[model samples]
Target: MTRRPEQFSLNLRPGNLRSRDPDARAARDFAARDFMDGGGAPALETGRTRLLVAGMVFALAFIVIGWRLVDIAAFSPGGEPRIAATPPAPAFESGRADIVDRNGVVLATSLPTASLYANPRQVRDPAGAAARLVRALPDLSRTEIRAKLSTDRGFIWLKRNLTPREQYRVNRLGIPGLYFEREERRFYPHGRLTAHSIGFTDVDNKGLAGVERSFDAVLRGRAEPLTLSLDLRVQHVLARELAAAMTEFAAIGAAGLVMDAATGEVLAMVSLPDFDPNRPGTAAPEARFNRASLGLYEMGSVFKIFTVAMALDEGVVTLDDGYDASKPIRIARFTINDFHAKNRWLSVPEIFMYSSNIGAARMAMDTGTAVQQAFLGRLGLTRPADIELAEVGRPMVPSPWREINTVTIAYGHGLAVSPVQMASAVVAVVNGGEFRPATLIKHAEGERPAGTRIMSRDTSLKMRRLLRLVVRRGTGRQADAEGYRVGGKTGTADKLIGGRYARDARIASFAAAFPINDPRYVIFVMVDEPKGIARTHGYATGGWVAAPIVRRVVERIGPILGVEPVRDGAHEDGGEELLVRAKARASKVATN
Candidate 1:
């Protein structure tokens, strides 16, 4: 069998048997011929087989990538399925109520802002990320930023109150682990103009001062905007005029308030050197102090209004009563002398017009301590004002109610009350003897609260006439508004420091009511530690310093508040007639 190989049969296993088909036979014959010709077999070479397989694999990969592109661009439309699309992160969970003026002008608001934060664990290159962040936020130190990023804390605030430019620059960095938290930041568009009344909020979106603190819970949860009684136009006028006065007098501090006498709503309250609520940390302590409601001072002769009103209300004196002011009265160790003394027997009208301390003391004696205390209590002077603000001051009244205390309080000394308290009391006397609680929030239509009656209607009318006469002919002559018939009393109290009154330190205040016939507005101005200027004739009295401020404020705000000026004779049927009759009777009695 081995002699002829081609014809011989070879034993083979089942897996090694060759096929007998024509195609297989032809392939085997061709392969044998090629091998005999010293050429490689047609089936495949070592490297070529690998090359062909790799080419097929590359084509398949291209087809797959193209299909995926089409699927992403056109096939799938609603949202990405392969990779989930992230949702926008929420900003502040708690929303704040809008603050608008009486005229619906936006005073304070919360605006959407992007604040930078970081997830320390997710940051790859903390040092590099911090450097880029610092470049974007100049206020942030590189070391501090790096330390915050490297910390173990899961989250940390990197920067707040970023500008749009800053946000864009930070986003461009594309640093890993850096993120933005949308937040609502409180903003005051009017800046320091309404600082005292509107107040400001803290970093946690909580109210910390002013009306913001008073109605915080109401503002945060409610959807309705908080409408305030403040009129932006009137507020601007008051602030502008007060700032001018503060600069002109070189005064250490200044305060002014405008209120609706009929409604007891504060229109504007200004305390000088006021800071923007948007940046409260930079404000001085004096600026944060609400002088209208927190700073109590013995408001000098303005107390004369209370004294005279009490005397009339108690029936201890009449408009026809006369007092002997022939000499300064010596009571115990205190001597009562008028700033401009009229050393003679003066009628009650004369006494008020001249601002005689002696005359005021005698009037208080007639009213008696019990009656005086009762009158003040009824007028809401013995307690803090019932307003929404947290910075109200309780009136400092003598505990013992001594004889000297009563006499001194009569002339605006030995008693301490806030300017707001004084203004509210004055409003009671002029607003038909009703004491309405002052309010910062706007009341609903037809929802007026009934006020307490503190004085008789007759006493109110009589006091209105007297207050008008004081502005027209007395030391408050500077407070006269040309057509408004502004009437008020001037007070100059020596400020108490370290338990003793400082002769050089003074708190000059003016309390005035406009359209004195039917009083509609009450304006109060106070200047603390005012220096006598050469232009002011070197006098720091309330009449010279604070009275002029009230005059300007009234002239500017009266028009804005819709208070039209009328001729003095127009009020003849109201309180002017009563004033004339009362003055005539006093003169006749004095002559007798």
Candidate 2:
């Protein structure tokens, strides 16, 4: 019942409503009759009406023919089009989220990029296209490009992760077969500075090392950056000092670690001979080795700190206990001697200060092997460090628990551990005997986690005093950062090369804590195969080479960490007179 009297629209039709010929012819009959017969046109419109009608019919037929031809061309009875230029769906959009240091400094991030692909079948001239592409991207192999273009595959990758300029140049070439698909390139803002910590990604942006590999799941499709406990400023300082020490001592490699003694959070970790994460593919294997956490070594006398702590904790030894270090002990084929041997009997503090290997071995013998191994296991040294890095070294302990093994391990030989392990163990020694699992993530302020107590609080306090005493008058004297109350041990051991210990090759290391009275940080540094230098008086020992590096690090980082210099303070036992005497003696020795 609906009325259909309205004019229909016609586009380019011969007899449309707007056509002059149609209007004139249709209204002529009415026009001649007069104004009484409704609206009309002028009367002279004659044969034009028939001509317009015929023309409209012919035009409609032509349109139908043209439409049919296009349909046949599109649907092709032969098969699908060979030159179909539809590109593959992208693998990632926006890519993985950013990675940042604890201070919100960007370490690793993603950048929008263009990748070129080719439809070989569509390439009219493979050789010419390949040549043009080579001109645009000289690094690309010309033979590979030509071979890929000649394939006749539906699609193939020509180049990946192209720069904006490169993409523009290639696009300007306007080769028919070439196409660009949007992608993202993984980038490191600091490049090699955080290479071992932030790690690098593959062409697909999948993490392969360091924190990037450990937290890949958290990063994928995540908008928020994954924040780590590392401070870039601290990392820079650590790296710079380690690099300088490596060059100064002519070391093959070096490692350094700075840890929060209270919270177990790693502030900074540096491994020399590091690679640029952005160009990891071209770096040497040695350069890629992460010495701080991934490489384990017999860390020499640094282990003495643990041995002494365990002895004091188990009541096997006391601060006043004395041991004879006048001569080396001959056990089996091994001779245990001290680098700085004291001719007479030495108290526990003197033995620690002088780094007497014989005294440390004797202390371990008294503590017993079973108890020593158990204590080390408790410190997480027998196993891999519980840090976030995927690359971690497993400690090398003796296969059979023997008496000699115990003694050698007491002075940090026979058993090899990573720098991180030594640093963490030292943290426990100074942090009121609490065993905190080292972490790469930050903990909230005043939200300290209760850790397992490995040693008595009384024993920890005594150990702190002994460490301070060593730094004050012992082999660790060079490690003293004035007013910082530096306290730690200097460890020197021969590197085992081939099948036997290499006497010429040694690992010199220093493990230290600052403001020993109220411990806040634990630092460890190791220089591998450092050749003796003239400035060090031809000594490759820890005290001479590694200790100074630790001193510099402490001095540089103290103010930044809000730890001001407290030059004057009495010992726990209130030995003000003895403290003044030691300072006077140190000043005299420095002047001499």
Candidate 3:
């Protein structure tokens, strides 16, 4: 019946009758529209488009999160961070104990610094990043940075150290793959002034030279500052004066030291052509050499000090003894003559004051080679200096000791010794004959190490008198500092090059002590290969070049070291009259 009467429902009595139930009519119309041919296609297409759009949005969010995680976890410039299942990197020496002078003035210390590095494999725009990096660090070469960044290496160092301000500037660039390592860099507060004595370290903070190396383990372990015997005031004074002398004389290099006569504590040591310890790797080999203790030279008449000391200590010669200086001594075609000959018999004081080569040779012979060698060994001269340095020069004394060696060595030729040895020996001669091992460490009160006696008090007294006489009236006349009572000897030696003495090259030196009535410090200054200056009257001798440096140093440091001048002399001391007696003896010999 339904099939026969399908149109029965279409009995349109009136459209208004169906409109009476508008809600139901609407639903029926909707159902009919869904069943119409080709109507379902648009609905299916709309649903699929909406679903695809939602999925794409979620996938993009995940992709962004993953990229961010990659950047933060592996390539952040802040440094590598450990996440789950990842280990942290090893730590480096972030700080070291401070190195300070005796008064706690900082000489060497550590500063917090930033060092730049990069993971080249993660660098996307290597060339662009390097150019920008170089802009922040203007000293960095652009090409080198690019090459480092373009590599496939996991990490590379861009710079070892950067200032905090520079680090901030670099961080603002916001480049990828760059990182910073927190580190402690060795910093020298005085720069080139303390370079040779304090030395420097490697990039990894390992000590390489000078006191830094000798006390590396101590520094690494201690928290308190390492107090050196050096006084900054003294060091500055010595360095300034030496530098001026170097410039004035046009010297290639210079070395100087001031040591405590009693305790053997080094107060100041300077070596030049010196470079800044902060950048020691860039320094030339010549500049890095510590001439104070490392360089060996035939120290000329400075050795006369030792010869006279040896003779006095061994009782082979007395202060009243005389030596013939009539002519140069000739041995095996090598002639030894005084620069200024007296051509007469001279007393011991006259020999030293005149720096007579023939007298020195005769004195050394009287002491004999065997006793001379033993005496020097006792004074720590036949071996390396006892100071705490890796660069100590072993004394070049002749082997199979012969008479010729003795004669030549007496006048300060044939044997080569370090200035440290020369200075220490002078210390023994002047400081009541006590031979204390030289040290860079500051000793506590009563904690000074025991010293061996190298000479008699009588001999030491004579040495003091003679040294004063030399500075007062002889070759070291220029070394006198008013009120300080500077007593020293001038030394000049021809530089040996290619096994022959160079005509125009010389080592000019002055070894001195101040306040000779009561000694406190010993100073030794040496100028290497000094050329004569016009102001110096065309003479590069120690009297002309090195003695003035000593005078200036003493004058400047005397007040600083609490050494008061005795302006109102009681006039009771006639020790200097001994020089007059020595001259009288020479005159007596001449009259005879």
Candidate number with the higher lDDT (2 or 3):
3
Give a tens-digit lDDT track for model 1, residues 92-158.
Answer: 4548988899889988888878999999999989999988888877889999999999999899999
Candidate 1 regions off by >4 Å? 1-93, 118-157, 172-177, 567-592
> Of the candidates shown, which would achieve the greatest lDDT relative to the real structure?
3
Backbone clash tally for model 3? 0
List where candidate 2 sits over 4 angstroms from the true fold: 1-93, 117-159, 165-178, 567-592
TM-scores of all models? 0.78, 0.76, 0.78
**Candidate 1 local distance difference test against the native:** 0.84
The lDDT of model 3 is 0.86
Computed on alpha carbons, the lDDT of every model, listed in order, comes to 0.84, 0.86, 0.86
lDDT of 2 by residue, 142-250 (tens): 9999999999798999888898999989989999978889888899989888998788888888999988899988899578888888888889998999899899988
Instruction: After superposing candidate 3 on the true structure, give the runs of residues whose Cα lies further than 4 Å from its correct spot.
Output: 1-95, 117-136, 140-158, 171-178, 568-576
Q: Arrange candidates by lDDT, highest first: which order?
A: 3, 2, 1
| Residue 373 error, candidate 3, Å | 1.3
